[model samples]
Target chain A: MPDDTTPLGAPLTTPDGFVALYRREAELVLRFCTRRVLDAETGVDLCAETFAQAFRSRRSFRGATQAEARAWLLTIARRQVARYLKRGALDRRAREALGIVTPVLQEGEAEEIERLAGLAPLRAALAEELARLGGDQREALRLRVVEEQPYPEVARSLGVTEATARARVSRGLRTLAASLELRWEGERP
Target chain B: MRILDELEREIERVAHAAGEARPRRRWWRSGALLVLAPLLAGTVAVAATTGILSGEPVSSDPHAPRDPNAGIGVNAGPGKLLAVRAADPAGGPEWGLRLVKTSRGLGCLQVGRVVDGRLGRLGQDGAFGNDGKFHELGPEILETSSECQQPDGAGNVFFAMTSIGQPASADPASCAVRPRGEDKRPACPRGSLRDVFYGLLGPEAAAITYREGGKTVRQAVERPAGAYLVVRATDPDRRDVGWWSPSVTPSWVESIEFRDGTVCRPDERPRRHGRHECPLKGYVKPRLDIATRAELATPITVRVGTAREKPYPEMDRKSLERMEWQRRVTISFRARRAADARSFYKLTAEIPGRPPNCGVGLGSPIARDIAAGETVTETLWVAHRCSGTMTIRIGYEQQTAPSQMPFHGDGPPNAKVGTARVRIP
Candidate 1:
């Protein structure tokens, strides 16, 4: 984990600074979108738009910490997702004005989204079950899965051993699976 | 796989666009320091010394000639006038003079460097058209100007009257501004008409033949390095010639056997005709490999089908058509490991054709791990269109270490383990 007090040597207001930020944060942003959208194609498009919007307004980014910068980017991504859900499609004109080349959806992507839509209620339940886990376990799982960090790095960041990190992830997955299974069985009855 | 590749490319594109949109402050700040400092100092000094700080219009001398070219003198160098003719014979004297005056900044006799039977390296001297007289010369006219210079060494020097227009494309190879017209009048005083042939050929060529105007000329190659060969013919004047490399088979030859075991034929079209014509297209075999010995714990056998399939519904037709076509290929492979340990292999497939447009998919490399002695069959979608042969090559590499974070820069080098090639129609 980066020291919270460490200042960003160069601000992201410049193009080169923004490029460095993109290189560091793009994969994390993509993984976040993938988990939310449940489809890789839509997730990739949203990631492009997210960065495009961030770049256009990069001068306005006044954050001093990496966490604040990340939070700022995620806020933009959340708005992008909301707009996408509300409009049922991406804003082509807005993307074009910002020089983003919009990608066409691949085959079966729409169908995948529709299929994942049916599990919306279960997703809410899963979120609740995730909150039920211990704070350490939840944090470990979030770093390893959502942020897509490696085990050793996640362990070091969370101030735990590799074995402890692995155990927390395993326990979290098992708990989520069990809760989902119980929910499905209850619905069947 | 294609979607992943497109996604990676999109990320790069968006990052680049964002960078381009931002204003570059460093360049402007540096430029201001370098330019403004000198200008500010000079302006302050001139204003203080001359006492002309108040704004006033500068007056011009009434006796000066209004024409920009009035005082320009002809300076064609010390070389004698070997030969001079209008650069554009069809444009007549008036158009030629106008072009020469405009291009050289003054109408005068222009000299050029005659290299390999071509005229270039133009230098001008004296005003010619300003006097409203077209300088005509018969055979053997002497030019005695000290300003006229020749190309370094033994290169021949040529001269031509100034013309008004320049060639549309200034690339020397395609430019048509030849000396003394295409009829081949002597550019140098000593009848230096020659034919120059220059081009690259395959390393296998043993000899080349020049066939032009009912005459045949041949040259032997001492060493073939697959480099450019320059064949010159000392004919007073000749521009058209047919070049043939007998030992070098045309790419369209499709099928030709050599005693040295070189495959000089397209694998797909063995019996195609027009073997004498040049091949319209070519292919580059992709690099496929498994990186290191530890990753190669198991022996793998890969088989790729030769048949072609239509593109999927969501795949853009116009995009595929630009590449010529799309071919869905099926790849099957079997791997067997001695130990029960898990192993991962990287598979890369590249179809040589038109590159995908912005936001279009180009397939990504696949990294999959299989159990010991397990066999997996997978289908790969590839773009399949080109005027020439389309080649598809696959390689496998093993992932030795855990993937790094940020994942932006070049990946760890992978050692190639196995490769397969498939050509499609």
Candidate 2:
């Protein structure tokens, strides 16, 4: 992924050319925001607030190439993973305004970042259906099925995931709201 | 350490302390330019005993005539530099302005900021390095030039806009927002509002097309320059073309063809591309980039690859009514790769939204036409304001032959007309 001409001649708003573009896209934006929030301390806190908001807009990186500075640092780690799945938590204000700490994850580090981002077989097939849900309906299915796009733009625009379109729109709006009693909101969030 | 090497050593220590406090905001604006060169010679004689003589700021920058108090030597009046520099395609600094003629004879306009690319450095101290000259913003902005030297109001290029991401108040001016955590080293380099027009284009100005948010909101003037420095990034949540002041006249600039062939009316208002005329030799226009160069980190290549669509049964009252208003998504565009109608085209498709979307996503329809593999199917409604990646870009234009607008050097009006980046995912 470093080949298609990542030669990039300096001037990336120099800080030693954005530390060589933070060493070629900081582990590909730390396993792409740790496999989109399957968590590794929230993928090292959204790869340190996406390289501290790409080093505070490193003079707004307009690229000449290095695959446009790795698609401008994975579009700022895909908008810091869509603002951490629409704020379930972990924004850490541009990585605590550049103090940037958050590492300490060694020992099998979130199964080596979900096994080098294969995402440990989708976290072991969603860990037996998230251990038959309970722990507040699995943190209310990661805080109510993040809609209005971002579960990778509703799983790359519906070809699935916001947990299979929130499990088939909560089983097709719970069988059309149990024969039309209505009330379909957050399906028991 | 190792949050990517402590976020690459805290971004090379805050971009090496904002690239070394922008060259010592020149010993703090060279002591407010010797306490404002005796307060801009007593505010140019209290702005000629107060009639508020209309301002129009402009002063050029080849890397600035080595700033020994520049341009007719800091308002001893008589001036020059309408050469026009305008570079910031986000490489930062390069915005030349200067229309000076003052000492009260009137016609002043000195806007500065010109590091002249790759920050080889210019505007060395604050208020855009006055010791080098273009100054006139009154009361030396906390000792000037770490670049972007504004304030210069002798009056007239329509200033007064300071209320929303700072920078713009001058026309009988006096402004200061300076608040970035009370000085962590900032003399200049504070920016937000950037409409920046930068003048000097009338030697029969042969080609210019404006339009940064308008023509009922973006119709395509998408960077067709030859008219100096035309900046604009707006969208502090699109308050109808995000505050383009002076009673919203950019009228999307539309067109301005000149070089003795005359063209001006797409709705007119580039003040008719500098109005004078006649010297035509070696014409090389068409470089148009400002759409913040499609938010950098390029390459997507017309691939449909992801962003599929369908499924969002009332996606949470449309994501809380898109945090209160602005949501229009309709993109349909059926295909056609030309076999007829003399390959005519204006095939625009623009989704250009970045940062949870601010504006752009609904352009297609310049009566689509294409040749040598043509296809055109259109619908266009696109505002889906938020959610990260959106870059649509169908753009395939070609029109540049207004009699070859005088020897035109062409290239990049969306690269001769072919760019396809689909990202919405």
Candidate 3:
């Protein structure tokens, strides 16, 4: 088995390392495509294409962090979205030529796909609510939640104290929840 | 239930294939190259065939590269040419020049001049020979020169093109005089000219010069009756230009009367923002009235009265049947002789201080046309949850067209406008 404590500089050139990176990032990349395409079948195909391209370019990746790897995959996904917008459909002739078959979505998968499709409108509403917050609070919340940045880095970027950054993120989230009528199951009011 | 697992397996298969193939470049790159290469090659070939690559006079073949700058002059007006001159600074005699009047009431000028090496191609803004191509000059260039002479007669204007920075002289004798009492064509219609003026000055126009087809023509010919005229008024402080049509009345204008009460005509106000007050008398106003029911309620229960005492008589029964909970309230309103002369009134209602979904209900007729002195009543159902003095706003709108529903603009001011409070319980 490969060592669990791989060096930071180690590249994902081996099949095991590539698979590990894929398992960590594939669901997120798939969700990103599903939100844009709004169709489960096509989104799965796009997800497959994104991973295929990422694997082909794995030897060329120079990132030293998992965040960099995720960003690289997201960049590829965005380019795929641009191509889909321009052509109105992803070209699947190459996949067909390679004898690759897309997976059929089962009955229970429809609800998950529909929930993913609803994310776009929900995010739009959240953005409108976010715009009503103070500029610092909005920026802190965006960096911490939407961008998934660590609170310390968010604080450094916004030039605020770590506690202030946490406070802003907390207040911003509470306000957005109230305005959008959203409730987190495990969260206290 | 296992669709995600299936997708993961599929992705793994594709990724394994991709790893084995190890393609050096994206497939779409090659496809794009295959499509764009031919187009790029064709563009280069066309550029080389035209003298665009090497500066030379274009070939005379009809298919030969045509000068981008040269084209038939725009239609001005049907008028006899009075004069023609070359006005060359190199002391060369004038070349062949003739003006023909077209059947569509436009005067077309044709002139042929020798291409002299000293007079380089006329560049933009009177700048000489930046490029080999002859460029059209903007009208501002003509206004700066005092040597360029104007044509004579009541509505005669000169049109000419010369080398950059050179003024073309006009001779009155070279102009042919129209025979006395000959029927002359009326001036070019002002509708198209007014459109051009608006295009130049945009929405905030203070003043504009009436020029036709990028030429320095200042002639104002007679406009036929009922034709639109774009007039520029001058005062010591400022100048303004606006459109006026003698025959048609503007939709907003009620009427126009002269100070002497001699001429009274219905006029339509131009749809624009500017000083449009004309030198005329009083105007008429639009009349509108609206009436409505201020209070209403939802029917909660109906009495059916025992239905001949339910054959069993052992059980004491009530006479009333409780209906399902209803949230809708009926509202009726009438509009009379609305200021807007349009056919229909678009109606809408809203409950202030409530979420958009809270006011959702059915049965409001979208629009109804009420004739002059005739009243039209419309009922709409609205849903609201709040009780006690809920403010309900009813809007009556007159749109330019019947199809423009849910009118966006506020209807005529004071056209039966009022708000009322109603009990929701």
- DockQ (Cα-based) for each candidate: 0.05, 0.10, 0.06
Arrange candidates by lDDT, highest first: which order? Answer: 2, 1, 3
Model 1: residue B297 alpha-carbon error in angstroms = 68
Stretches of candidate 2 above 4 Å error? Answer: A1-28, A33-53, A56-111, A114-116, A119-189, B1-43, B46-50, B53-166, B169-178, B184-194, B198-225, B228-425
TM-score of each: 0.24, 0.29, 0.23
Ranking, DockQ, top scorer first: 2, 3, 1
Q: In candidate 2, what are the lDDT values of residues B226-272, reduced to their tens digit?
A: 32456554344532221112111223345555666676554433221
Give the range where candidate 1 chain A is weakest over 10 consecutive residues by summed lDDT. Answer: A91-100
- Residue-level lDDT tens digits of model 1 in B168-268: 11111112222322212212211222222222232343434444456654444222222222213233232221111111122322233322444333444
Error of 2 at B128 (Å): 14
Docking class of 2: incorrect
- Model 1 alpha-carbon miss at residue B211, Å: 93
lDDT by residue (A1-189, candidate 3, tens digit) is 114333323345554556667777677777777765556667776776676667655654645567767777888777676566434567442333232344556676756765655665655776688888999888997788667788899999999899999889878867876876653233211
